[model samples]
Target: MLAVALAAQFMALLDAFIVNVAAPTIQSELHASGAGLQLVIAGYTITYAVLLITGARLGDRLGHRRVYLFGLAVFTVASLACGLARGTGELIAFRLLQGAGSAVLIPQVLSLIQRNFAGEARVKALGAYSAVLATGAAAGQVLGGVLVSADLLGTGWRPVFLVNVPVGVVLLALAFRVLPRDDAAALAAGRARGLDLPGLVLLGAAVSLFTVPLVLGQQEGWPLWSWLSLAAAVLFFTLFCAYESRLARRGGAPLIAPRLLRSPGMGLAVFRVAAVMAVNAGFLFVVTLHVQGGLGYSALRAGLTFAPSAVVFGAVGLTWRRWPQPLQRALIPGGFALAAVATAAVGLLLRDGGDGGLWLYAALVGVGAGLSLGFGPTLTRALATVRAEDAADASGLLATVTQLGQLTGVACFGALFLHRLESAGAPGAYSSSDALLVCAYALASVAALGAVSGLVRLRR
Candidate 1:
């Protein structure tokens, strides 16, 4: 059961990055605009963010096992669709549905671990789960590259998505046999809460409004409608919040409980987690693009370059709980600082026209990232202090926030990097030096913010 759950997580995290290495290839083959390529990434993430809370709520209402299987079926079939997709539009549409399926699959995973294991056994299971997850995320970059480079069976980049189908099927079969049946009374009572249809529609609208501008802005040359879309995003989000609060107060089943936001520690924890996740996902996206897109490395080489980070991150993540609270809190901030330094160093190396030093920079950032993201345990612990029913709600919210932060981070950094390249012009065009320098400055700025946020939280 644990193996099956971890496999599901592995696929989700892998899906996140595996498509990135194939982006350039995807663009050329499908004749996609820059905006279309970004949609390949953004479409999925936005849907994942918007539907995550609802997915968790559904899992709670139905049996987690039942919901998990349903999600698996959707995800597996979608993976096939993604691989078979012949054009940009088809891929992006399918990817959005893929994200929806993934959202349903993820929340129940943690719930299952918590429900199944106890004490030391649980800790070990969770630790392994965490480690596998981090490993999968890091490994995805390399795996994507290798698969694309291999071009096995003449599949080109599509194999990355195609690969998930078989794995998902295996998991689904195991899930049906191994997953424990749910408590009839608990399941019945949970379903009594009903779906938050209004909340879902409003949240989905808000996400679509927010994402359309960021995605279309770059490709469409930042037109008036893009700005208007941004304005609409704000308005929709504001309306969503007000409506949700009113519904909660009226004794309605809100998608997210309004009271959860009022909880001091949990609120802060979620924000902190969001920040870290934003930086983490952003950094990965930028670095991958820089290596493969900017530096012109082969896909396989670019992926392999990330190997050091993946190994150390898994190791540190496994031992995170053993560290003292003070150290645990500092991990994220320190990691961010180290990552910034590494980013700067990469810039310096590029300025000097040096080669072969990327491994060192990769190591520094990887180590920091490992220790930093290791704090997930602490964040989950903080949220666990909330009530049981609220636990699902809180976790769902945190997941949504993390996904949103990830989207923002990737778009912001990727945009800045591209912007800098455009400004630098051609001939002597945006050298790797200029690009790395910009990446460094951006990362350093975000790191400082993360550090301050962490310190302030500690003080409070």
Candidate 2:
């Protein structure tokens, strides 16, 4: 059961960044502009982030097993559609569908683990889950490069999507055979509670309004419409919050329970996760562009460049349990600090027109170590104060925040990278150096903020 759950998660997370290494290829082959490529990446993340909470609610209301199967089927079909897409527009549309399917699939993995495992067993299951997430992300980069370079049957980047079909089919079959049936009583209770349709709509609208402008603004040369969209995002988000609070006060089940947000550490957790993930997502997206797009490295070489970081990330994650509590708590700020230094070093290396050498690899290792160490620990701390009954809600909200962070990172950094390229007048090793430097400094500032927050919370 753990193996099956991890496999499903692996696939979902893999799709998140697998396209990074392939972005250049897709653009060249499909004649996709920078904005089109950004959509190809951001569209999936946006949909996935927006729908995650709703998907988790559906799992609770329907049944984990049932919802998981449905999501898997949708994901499988979407993968096929993505592979078959003949143009950038078609690919972006299919990727959105794929992201929706993933939102459904991911929450169930955690639900199943909580339902099926107990005590130490549950702890181990969660650890394994985290490992899969880290590994899958790294593997996506490597696997994407291999598929694109292989061009199996002269298919180029199509195989990256096509490959999921068989794996999803096998996982679906295994799930049916191995996963336990739904709890009839829980299903009944969930059915009795109505879905918060209004909350869902408002939340989705707010997220789309905020993210769409980030993606489209620079591409359209920052027209008046983009500023209007940004303003609309604020309005929609304010309205969504007011509506959710009203619903919760009325004893209704809000899309995000107000109580969850009120918990100690919850607000800080959300901020930290958003900041860290933004840097993580932005770093990967920009580095891929710099190495493959600017430096003219092959897909395989670019993918392999990430190997050191990935390995270090996995190692740090696996051994994290052995660290002291203070060390564990400090990991968030410490990790971010290391990542900031690494990013700065990489920017310098690129600006100097030097090939990223041993130092570059070391810096990547720092990034992986910091992010991996910080991620799970921060999540655990964030949910520590929530009641048992609200655990599911807390988990869902946290996951949603994580995805939003990724979306922000991708959209913002992608736009910045493209704009830099245009102003620099050509793609070269140092053309995007200023963008990278800005991101690195921003990360450093965020790390300091995390440290201050941690200290303040302790003093309180």
Candidate 3:
């Protein structure tokens, strides 16, 4: 059962990142526009974020097993569709479907783990889960590179999507046999939602309004609509907060309960997580592009470059809890500072189309080692202070926030990188290096902010 759950998770997280290594190939083959490529990436993340809470609610009311199977079916079929897609529009649409399926199913893994495992067994299950997830995310880049470079049957980048079909099918069979049956009460509740639908819509609207412009503004020459859209994003977000607050006051289970945000240190902790995730996703996107798109590195080589970062990150994340209490506490701030330095070093090393040498690999390792502390530990630290019951809600909210942060990073930094290429007159090996260099520095600044935020939280 644990293996089945982790396999599903591995597939889901793999798709989240596998596209990075294949992006240049996809663009060149499909004749995809800059905005189109951004959509290809951000669309998945946006839909996943918007529907995650609702997905969790569905499992509570409808049965985890039932919803999990349904979601797997949707995801499997969508993966096939994505592989068969002939154009940018088709691929982007399929990607959204894939993300929806993922959202519906992913929350159930944790629910199932909690339901099925207990005591020491549960602890071990969760550890394995975390390790597999960390491995999956890093492995995606390497795997995608291999598949694309292999050009099996001359299919180019399509293999990345198609690879999921068989795995999903096998998982579906195993899950049906091994997944525990849901309680009678869960089924009786049916499709009913305790969801905050209005809040969901408002949040979705705000993100879409904001992200659409970022991805497309340069492609469309920055029309008046872009500015109007960004303005609308701010307004919608304000309305969302007000609505959540009102619901909380009335004792409703508001999406992202306002009281949670109001808790001491909670908001800052959330911001620190968001900043780290934004930098993480943004760094991967731009650097992959810089290497493969601009510097003519093969997809395999490009993906392999991230090996150090991935290995160090997973190792650190798994073992961080073993450190002494004081050292663990200090690690968060220190991790952020290390990440900031490493990120800036990357920028400096790669500024003129030169791949940062062995030192560059060292910087990448530093990035992975540092950000790993800022993520899982930050969550554990924040939750240590929260009441037990609210832990689930806080976890769901943080999950959604991380997805939003990823989408935001890809849309904004990707747009800037694309625009830089356009203004410089056609991308070349060295011409677009500065674009990535600039974005790297910006990410470093965000890392520095996380460091400062962690320090302030420590003082408080």
Candidate 4:
């Protein structure tokens, strides 16, 4: 059961970064504009983020096993569609569908872990899950590069999407054979409560309004509608919160339980997760573009550039269990510090059109190590206070915010990268010093915040 769950998780997170390495190729081949390419990536993340909380609720109401299988099937079909897409619009549409499938499957993995494991065993399982998440992300870059570069049967970038099909099939079979049967009584109870449709709709609208404009504005030259959409997003989200509060007060199950917000450490966890994930996503996105689009490296070369960082990340994960508690706590800020330094170093290397040599690659390894140190610890800390009954909700909320971080990172950073590129009047030119320097500074600020938070926790 654990293996099957991890396999599904690996696939979901893999898709997130795999498309990143292939982004330039997708853009050139499909004649996609800068904004269109952003959409191809951010669209999936936005949809996944929006539906995550609701998907978790559905799994709680429905059987986790049932929902997991259904979502796997949906994701598999969507992968096929993505691979077969004939245009930019079609690809984005299928990617959105793919996100929906991911949203459905992801929370179940965490919930299943909580259900199946206990005490120390549960902690180890959670640790393993985090390791898998990190591995999937790092592996995506390497695998995507290999698939696209190999161009097996001349399929080019299409194989990246197609690769999920066979893997999904085998997981589906294994899931059925190994996963525990759903509790019939629990399913009936969940069905009795029904879904909060209005809440779901409001949440979706709120997210779409905020994300769509950010993604489309730059490409479309920031029209009036884009500004209007941003404003509307604020209003819709306010309304959703107010309605949810009211619903909770009236003895009803709200979309997000109001009580969950009151749980100790929940808010801090959410913020830290958002900040770290944003940095991770933005850094990877810009680096990929810089290497492939700016430096004129092939997809394989760009992918290889990230290999050292992936290795360092895996090494950190493997050794983390042995670290002293004080050192373990410090790893969060320490990792972020490494990331900030690494980004700055890379920016210097790329300044004035300099070839980023082995030194730059060394910085990337630092970034990966920093990511390994920060991400898992922050996640574990965030969920430490959550009760078992609320595991599904907490998992959903965490996953949602994590993806939102990725979406925000890609949207905001991609916009900056594109704006800088355009202003330089150099097509295919990447100004890492301008855009990446800002990103580095932002990451540095986050690291400082993490350090302060760590100190406060220690005093308590």
Query: What is the C-alpha lDDT profile of model 3 across 37-130, one tens digit per residue?
Result: 9789767766776677667667766788888898889989999999999999999999999989988877777667666766556555655554
User: How do the predictions measure up, each by TM-score?
Assistant: 0.89, 0.91, 0.86, 0.91
Clashes of 3: 0
Error of 2 at 54 (Å): 1.6
**Model 2's lDDT to the true fold?**
0.77
Residue ranges of candidate 4 with Cα displaced over 4 Å:
23-42, 86-90, 184-189, 192-194, 425-434, 458-460
In the range 218-310, model 2's lDDT, one tens digit per residue, is 667778987898799899989989998888788888877787787777887788777767777777777777777667789888888888877
User: Per-residue error at 324 for model 1, in Å?
Assistant: 5.5
Cα lDDT, all candidates: 0.72, 0.77, 0.78, 0.79
Who is ahead in TM-score, 1 or 4?
4
lDDT of 4 by residue, 95-167 (tens): 9999899999999999888777887667667777777766666688889989988989988789999999999
Residue 226, model 1: lDDT of: 76
Clashes of each: 0, 0, 0, 0
User: How do all the candidates rank in terms of TM-score, highest first?
Assistant: 2, 4, 1, 3
lDDT of 1 at 361: 56
True-structure lDDT of candidate 3: 0.78
